[model samples]
Target chain A: MNARAIDVRGLNKSFGDRHVVRDVSIAVDTGRITGFLGPNGSGKTTTLRLLCGLLTPDSGEGTVLGMDFRARGDAIKRQTGYMTQKFSLYEDMTLEENLAFVARVHGLDNRRERVEDTLHRLGLFDRRQQLAGALSGGWKQRLALAAATLHQPRLLLLDEPTAGVDPKARREFWDEIHTLAAEGLTVLVSTHYMDEAERCHDIGYILYGRLIARGTADAIIRDSGLVTFLGEGPGIDRAAHLLARADGVLSASAFGAAVHVSGLKREALEAALVPWRKEPFRWSEVPPSLEDVFIQLMGRERDERYTS
Target chain B: MTGSLPRILAVLLKEFTQLRRDRITYAMILVMPVMQLLIFGYAINMDPRHLPAAVLSHDTSTVADSVVAALERTGYVDVRYLPRSDEELDQLIRRGQVMLGITIPPDFTRRLLKGERPQILAEADASDPQAAAGALAAVSVLPTEALRHERLGLGAPRSTAPAFEVVVHRRYNPESRSPFHIVPGLLGIILSMTLVMMTAMAVTRERERGTMETLLSTPATPAEIMVGKLTPYVVVGLVQTVVVLGMARVLFSVPMARTPAGWLALACGIVLFIVGNLSLGYLISTLARSQLQAMQMSMFYMLPSIFLSGFAFPFLGLPPWARVLGEIIPVTHFLRIVRGALLKDQVLADMGNDLLALGLFVLAVAGAALGRSRTTLD
Candidate 1:
């Protein structure tokens, strides 16, 4: 069997009286992409930091690339490349200069050749002389990706790498990530976009510092056991509000000109939609989507953790 | 550690390249001290000559002429105008036209002939009371001229003799060459100011740019990083010391009686002390959130050092409480050591206490900085 690229268990962290991460565990296979999906401040970034040795957990036992996470942090750091959410490059320097600085910092041999190759691979060779600050968001994202991969680390830990990137740019970024994964680079990326999460081999959904669900996109949707019905009409906003207050309705949210109503009990969801069926609104029972399952999961979890 | 050598060298090279790009910093590093030396070297004058004075001769006789000649002979005073009226003399003193105004009464020649003692009126500007005191002593010498003629029996009656005598002794800086006093202290201020400001800002800039974290994650330990950052500034400090000392010799003619090697060694020690102070500043920068706050804190420390370090003012003349406060500053001890070695040709034995104080300060500050850098948080 191939060794796991990341294997960690029973991770916990607390800041003052608040537990930021609680008993979280996850594993990603070698050369596979795993998505960490959550809302803001949902322990996703903290977990990523813990995995990459950027932060030490209060109580945890984990091995990253066969090295102990706590004791061999330096070794782990040397073998992993972390790209932070913010644009953390020297803004005054040109694109080529920024990349060359990272290369030299890593003490990589053939630095000039490596920098040329990385820039060319990112399709940024034409704009190599442009100052980093002057580049558009898309080009800046490309530069960050190139700098992250210049050292060729085995594992890549990315924290919300596509937060402010446009849809087209984000799609291109995901394509490049997949290409890197195909070359046997293990990637663990956290993202808020559902489409980005769907592209992952497996997904972990965290809420309020707790892992609520984990599986493939299809399995997470299937195993959630939620029955969702869509109501299409001109006045769906009132219907969504009324259905949200209705009995047995797990979650109701608007999704692009349609209101998707979901409940764990199929009969109850159908009964809740029965009142809206007499008007111009049309209700159709459909298979639950990943968004529906996640919304229902989020509805079931508390907004904050309670300690007894 | 061996594998990280190339990486450390790369970081050093990158820092140097970035420093080169910052032309303002380059100019500050190279030009500021020389300009300060040239300007301040001329501005500070301890030995002042050619003070303006007014002479009032109530008797226009040879004795009064002799008195005027005596005052002119001293070369310390320049008799600007002989006022015809005493009110004019008072006006000259009030307007600051003359710092000293002397009056010879009409009975001055008759008093000398009758053997009655006559007092000469000498009024002076007492704003800078010390300046007036020096002028007063100089004016008293004029009466000695009259006595000298009487003793020689050439131009004065033999019956007239001076009843009392006055003697003057100048203290502290006898020759009053400003450079002798200023250059030694300027060396301390220049080294501390440049080293602390530059190193503090440089370290803070790295942290601000997120490069410090990159360096931390490397195989280089905190100690290695600190040493690498400090080494270049030490070299710069040594070069500045040499330039300042050379300028003092060429322009101000300040002499150094000790061997060149001894001076160099002392300067190296001072530079080390400065580097240690700058390292402490870097530790402060790490705690600060912005460049402005770092600069403010540096200035806060620098202002007191300039005032209390005995560089601009005499440490001994300060009040007891001020002196006690001044002793806490490293620059205070550094100024004392530099001036003692350069001016007095003081050997290490004579400066054992100052050397010990500087050594302890360096170790304490360097250790604190290293300790602070070891922890990730402020």
Candidate 2:
């Protein structure tokens, strides 16, 4: 083993009576991109915070970069760069000034040279003197990233870093992340976009404070045991509604012009679609996508927790 | 702690840079006290001058002229108008045109000639009680001095009877220069209000913006960050104290009873107290959610300090309950210490209780602030 960059296990965090993160365990290999995906209140941000020592877990034991997560949090924090969900930089300060402040805060030597290089590398050298508040969302994201990585931290924890960014800027940002990963920096990124998760080396899916699955995207899709059938023609939304309540149908969601119906039982899914065949609809069986598998997984987990 | 020194220096440099960018805050921090010193030095006067008086002279003769001369010579009263009737005098008093009304009896000169003790009826407008008392004192002295001359025959007036005596004593501030009293108290008020408010807002703004957590996650500990943030404000506060004291001396002629070194020592103690209070404000800011809430909390604490701290009013004049409330304010004790040392020339031994009170206040507030900062989650 090449020494995991982040090795946290059995992490538990609770905000009063509600458990935010429950007995979560995960590890990221050195220089690998790990995707954290979950619903809105699924503890992804909390887990990311715990991994970077920004928050102290209520209970559990772990190590980040060979430092004890509980005992040597300061050391872990010093070696990690965290980009918050919001655009958090001094709005009154110019782009160059904000970067310089971060550099000075970390006590980086040769501050002027380092700030100059970081600005040039991020393609923000031309807009260096513009105030941070005036920058577009894409430019602000670049500035935040530059500030975060200025200290050359060993790990990067990005919490929904591309929430408001455009597609082109997001693609460029991912390219930058991959470039940094190539230089031996581990990245733990939480994202809602499925394409972004597919780009990661491995994925962890969390639901309601619990880690439901962890594997490659293809592996998770296959392991879900979801069999999906596409029904395309008129009245797909109405058909999707009928299919959602049908026996043995786990979930039915509209994917573009077609309704994708998925279930864990292959024979039962086909039997349920027999009534739909009476209408003028083109039915075709297809390999279940990552989205279909996750929908079916969410359906099964929701029933398991709620019914019990 | 090998790299701690450099880190501290780095933090200090960063703070100064930020402060430089906040130009409005910097101007308020540096210029307000000096401007206040100039305004209050000239505006506040305890020994009021140019008070208007109405004379109802039934005996409109040379004796009345002589009485007006004596009143003018005292330099406390300005005889504005001579009313013909007592009704007119009453109208003048009611209209606030005159602060005092003097009625010279028709037999005023004849009474002195007959060797009878004549009393001039002097009615004063007591609406503004302090000015009223001063005006009455000025008018009464005029006849008694004239009577003494009449009995002794010093300047050609001869009399058979002696005159009643009048004595006056100015208390608290004998010279009655506003700066002498106000400047010393201002030292306490300015230091406490500005230092506590500024530092509290700065800390709370960072926390609201989520920058405190980012700053804390660095190698800096809570103590290191606090000390770094506090160092510049202490310097700034001391500079302001010196500026205010220097302006008081130049503009108001407020005497500096102690030596420069003594003033410097007092300034250091006051700066320490201010920093401690500011730390307490920081703790309050941490508990508050936003800057507006932090400001409201600061004002809530500040109102009692201003009213009960004996800066604007005399502490001894307050009731017993108010006195107890005054004792609870650190600024109240600090004002006494600074004023006693600078104005009254009292030594440290004479101000032992005040010094102890200030020390206890600083220690208690600082201990609570640091404890809260460590325990609270940002």
Candidate 3:
């Protein structure tokens, strides 16, 4: 078997005049969970859709599940599961009915047993008779996940699976994702949350229809070349706005009582922090976080857009 | 292919569940056909009676008075106006006050007594030909009846053959009942409007509800999706057929196919016509982006089908181009099959062209619908 569940190159997709996914290439290994982080309309969802057979690329050449994806879309679709950003299951159907539908669509032999097992495993058995539309936001997503994975697909693609979900529910959802990945199911998920990015085995940050930074969370932060400083004082949080507009400051923001300022050059960052470095204020060089690196990356892309 | 049946069943069950949950679709399915049947069956009349007419008689003789009296006994014309001149009668007819006019000349009684064969001119407003046909036919038989009555008093021999006699045999509908003509055609029309609109909204509803993306992401093929989604609706269409046909039989007393073979032919035609309409609606769903757009598109299709497909008008009466256009609509061929099998007792063997046309329509429209259906979001 191939080590990668998905191996694709030069995947291009466009809607009318807007080129949404531009020359994107990605490779995801089996049994690993990969997270995609990007701003809205950055092609993260489009790239996820293209990997599965949910969308046809304008121009692409790749093999998904050891077969040519474009030529053998039906074959690829059978092995792939996609959960849309929205609650895509039939809102009018009961939870049990939705899972049964997915199971039957995949032609599972033990449809009832599988639906029962999934409902119980997801802790949704108690409310299986309720209409899916009546479920809370977190439960709706959990049901969506249950339906997507009901067929035991080799690869699972989730688009913003927890947008409006609470922190506890999101954590539980990630725990379930990790448990599935440990059993050798490949997952590619997209989200706007930084904590979710930290939970992934690998991360890809997209900007303006292009995948710009890709690595483990720690490695991406290290490779971003962003130097960050922590400043703490009585009113140091107010200096975030002033330092954000400085020459070398890429991003400056207040985190409760302390303010974090990041830049590419250490001297430039230190020089920008000079005003708040007086009397009671204490300054220390700290490691750049994933969010700080992503913010810097977005600022860099914005500068590139203006200059070019 | 092995998984096709299961996938189709999955879609069929899902559609059924949603339909059961939707109260609006249930109301539409039951109420729309019966309401339209009542409105069209009871309210509209193609053959009218007791039409208003104007009579102007210049001769005040007994012969002229008896002729005028003979016109009213036909039950078609009601002589309500006694205009003084031709211009007054013309004004009454032109302004839509009266439908017919009768004028007696000055020398009518003298000419009739001398065997001059004087003419009593009868004029009709022929703008609505259906309304005028019965009234004018009544006037034509008047001369013979009145002359036969006059011969008894004049003492003339009744052995000689009078003028020409017209013997018309109106087959199937001797009484010219409007319901007999309209009810069978209503079957075609009701199926076209409801089946097309229902199926057209099927796929678009998924798209609008954002479930289409998830559906496309599954292992289901386009063929599987189409077959699965359409099967439940096919049952619905069949039930509607039974409803409309039952109402036609019980309420309107419309005749049905006589022999077993003829009934089979009707059944086959009905199935083909339902599938054809469902396929056309699926094709519209592929073209439309929303349920509203699907409804609008179904309406756009229904207008031409109702007008050009011999449902509301006579098929042969249309212009050549319109007749050619009517031949393309599935309702046209289906109407022919229905009217033939029910009223004329035509079997499958007798209606080869119409059945073949309906069969070809199903194949062509189903092929187009499947071709246009997308397996992917693109």
**Top TM-score model:** 3
State the weakest 10-residue window (summed lDDT) of model 3 chain B. B162-171
Off by over 4 Å in 2: A278-280, B1-172, B347-349, B374-378
Q: Mind giving the per-residue lDDT tens digits that candidate 2 earns over B333-353?
A: 876767655654545555567
How would you order the candidates by TM-score, starting with the best?
Answer: 3, 2, 1
Clashes of 2: 0
TM-score of structure candidate 2: 0.74
Shift of residue A169 alpha carbon in model 2, Å: 0.5
lDDT scores of the candidates, listed in order = 0.75, 0.76, 0.83
* Alpha-carbon shift of residue B297 in model 3 (angstroms): 1.7
For every candidate, the chain B TM-score is: 0.56, 0.55, 0.60
lDDT of 1 by residue, A1-308 (tens): 34799888899987778888999988888998999998899999888877766667899897888788888887877778878677778789999999998887677999999999999999999999999999988888889889888989899988899988899999999999999999999999999889999999989998888888998999999899888888888878666777888888988888766898999887787787777887677788888888888888877776333432
Worst 10 residues of 1 chain A by lDDT: A299-308
Please, what are the lDDT tens digits per residue for candidate 3 over residues B1-378? 987999999999999998797664565567657745743454334555567777788877766567667778887777889899988876666444566787788887666665656677777654334555666776777767655676557765554443223233234565667788788888899999989999999899999999999899887888999999999988998899899889989998988889999899899999999999999999989888768768867876886688777678655444556668779999988887887788767678666888899889889989999998888787
Higher-scoring candidate on DockQ, 1 or 2? 2
Q: What is the TM-score of each candidate against the true structure?
A: 0.72, 0.74, 0.78
- Top candidate (lDDT): 3
Binned by DockQ into CAPRI classes (incorrect, acceptable, medium, high), candidate 1 is incorrect
> Model 1, residue B278: what's the lDDT?
72
iRMS, candidate 2, in Å: value is 2.9
Tell me how far the alpha carbon of residue B245 in candidate 3 is from the true structure, in angstroms, after superposition. 1.8
